[model samples]
Target: MYLFKKAKESIVSSLHGDKSSPIIKINYICNCILKITLAICLWLSSLSFLALYLNADIINKSLFQLFSLSSLILSCLSFIILKRKNGTYILAKIKMYPFSFKDLVDVSLLTGVVTISVFDIILCYLYLLVAFAVFVIATCSIYECLDNPYMRDNENISSFSLSFISVLYMGLYVISNGVIFRNLPYNPLEYMGYIIKNIIEDIFSVTKKLTKLII
Candidate 1:
């Protein structure tokens, strides 16, 4: 009841452009906690479902593919929505869209749920732990960036850059781990080594492409 009241008050304040209201801050904090809790619950439930039916090879393979593909597509869509203007408008045009907010909360929760589900099937627990850690860090970074007064007030150092940085960090972690649709076994230490090699190669590749474009 308290949460409902606060949410209503926050919505009204936002509509009225009452940015100074304490309810706005409370709403933001509550919303973040709710999203994190939902994501964690969804992830744990998905894992449990998978574990309980591990013996069903056909079902297991089908679900693994389904969640993996869904996660990849949703992640890409989420990034595009974050980076583009009129993204919400675009999303609204899509048929049978379920969610209202196509922003951080939706993206984070879906990513968390699907990522853990997919990784649980293919990768070892260590890799799953790394992925979850990255997810948490990235989510927190985005929230901080959005909440930061300096970032919010400044046009130059926009929140989008911080969001992009968080995405880049996650991308690097994923690339280092060599996570793909095809499950492959690898040592965690070797994965770290691969990360360094991949980063250096990516830098050189980008440098060469830039030089070519300039020429």
Candidate 2:
């Protein structure tokens, strides 16, 4: 029994060693922080739903929209600060590092968040094609980052990551449902599927276009 316990501990230790990589650490920390921000977003979304229930006046309604947008912007800024290099906005010190594919994916995800935020704000909360495109690619990128075998063997971290993502989606669903009921024309799940469909169509269209050009 003692030998078995020792073996188990050794295995656990080795599994955890993989998560110690700087890239994984940064990604995990960023995900944790984003999850917290998402919780706040969920709370605010609940309040917005309440305000709507109370039949708040136009100015109050406008303020709710403004605050929602503000929160979204802040959450996005948080992601960018942790994941990307920006000269103009200094939440953390600016430093240049060697470019890597993972970094490119992080940048692309951040770009999608920014682009989605702008469109959602300007179009009065309509989910657009670019938003859909960025969302899928970003998620795939993050999953790829988490694909290390040793890290995958770390059951605790794996559970935490799964829980965090589940909560994020739940929060998004609640907010999107609120938006849809309030006649904002955004159903989070439906919008996601729409985005996926568009992505497939766009890929096929691009393939056809390239083939025609070659022909």
Candidate 3:
């Protein structure tokens, strides 16, 4: 806890873009706790599914019950953590999207769509959901970081261009790599796709820099 506080203070000072004296480190420990807990819960949920698939006799009924319990616990934790923060209000002041119920719904839908597509057998929708989720999440995250009050440089058009290109690269990469190979499921091709995505992503990133220069 002390270390986290210290880290937050340091980050605040850095964001101020100066050697500041006193910085009231935002006490978002509850958010951090919930985020970590959420990750664990998700991992456990995935593991439960895997277990059910591998050992249907033992895991069939229990898997559903465990998943339900986990979901409930995670929901309670999220509600408790978000209740006081009201991220929407805080984020509005910064001219950015604050974490809210909408984001939760989006993420839930994304996860469901991705998992079903990736793990389903016949009649599978392929990896479209994973690719789409990756694109959307990456876009939102980049936009948020670029628009953040603590770090944005409104005067620099280059910054905006760079962020824009970064998002495009991420979107393209995920689309090509995720959706294209779901049915085949080849190891070497999957690896190649990943490599190609990175290359393409980097290539497109150069365009942003070029555009910045031209603009």
Candidate 4:
């Protein structure tokens, strides 16, 4: 937020520059902060995700591992494109607000995803998606009686990388009434799947019985 506010102020100030003040040149670096960010923070984030997947039982372990490894490699590759020497710009510091807006946004985005992965928020959100999808599918199938005109259930993956970043960096996972993922650490995959399936089916069975009154 501070970065955005500063950037916004810089833009407005630049448009109404004082002709009275003389212009000065500053050593200009393109995306210097992002270069530092990828070289350090994101590199660590990738390795951290890799370490987790290697030790923990991820749902799609191999793909997750590959994603992490690829990210780590990409962060390494960022150095190849780095500027060899600083360029010059007129009042560059004020013009760029210390760094480009994109640089800070990228940092924030990477940090958010890493936080989610580290805190296991992704796993929690996965089930939330599953439950929402299940409910939507069920309700949509019975839409005529329910009078819901908005009736569509879709998953965006095979067709879309979901901003491409999603499939590549922060992968999306979906389960259709499957085992709770966190349970994999404790129960056998098969047993866990069975438990969740039964629970969902039983809930629906009861719902079906009660819905007879609504119909």
lDDT of 1 by residue, 104-211 (tens): 111122222211122212222232344455456566666666676666554533244435545654564455333221122335565456556656766787899899
- Runs with alpha carbons beyond 4 Å of true place in candidate 2: 1-18, 58-215
Cand. 2 TM to true fold = 0.27
Model 3 ranges off by over 4 Å: 1-26, 59-64, 67-69, 72-215
Candidate 3, residue 53: how far the Cα is off, in Å: 1.9
lDDT for each residue of candidate 3 in 1-215, tens digit (9 for 90 to 100): 43344455445645675322211112233244334445544554455455455554531243234443443454344444345334322212111111121211211222222111111221111122333343454465466555656345565433343344335536445443333233222466655665566556666778888999999
The most accurate candidate by TM-score is 2
Candidates' TM-scores? Answer: 0.22, 0.27, 0.24, 0.24
Q: Give one digit per residue, the lDDT tens place, for model 4 in 3-66.
A: 5554555566577876443222112122342255355435544554745545564333344344
In candidate 2, what are the lDDT values of residues 53-136, reduced to their tens digit? 555442234434544454455445444433433311121101011111111211122222221123212221122222333334
Q: Positional deviation of 68 in candidate 4, in angstroms?
A: 1.4
Stretches of candidate 4 exceeding 4 Å from the true structure: 1-29, 44-50, 53-56, 83-215
Which has the higher lDDT value, candidate number 1 or candidate number 4? 1
Which residue pairs collide, candidate 3?
none
Q: Give the TM-score of candidate 4.
A: 0.24
Clashes of each: 0, 0, 0, 0
Best of the two (1, 3) by TM-score:
3
At residue 201, give the lDDT of candidate 1.
Answer: 69
- RMSDs, each prediction? 25.3, 23.3, 24.4, 23.9
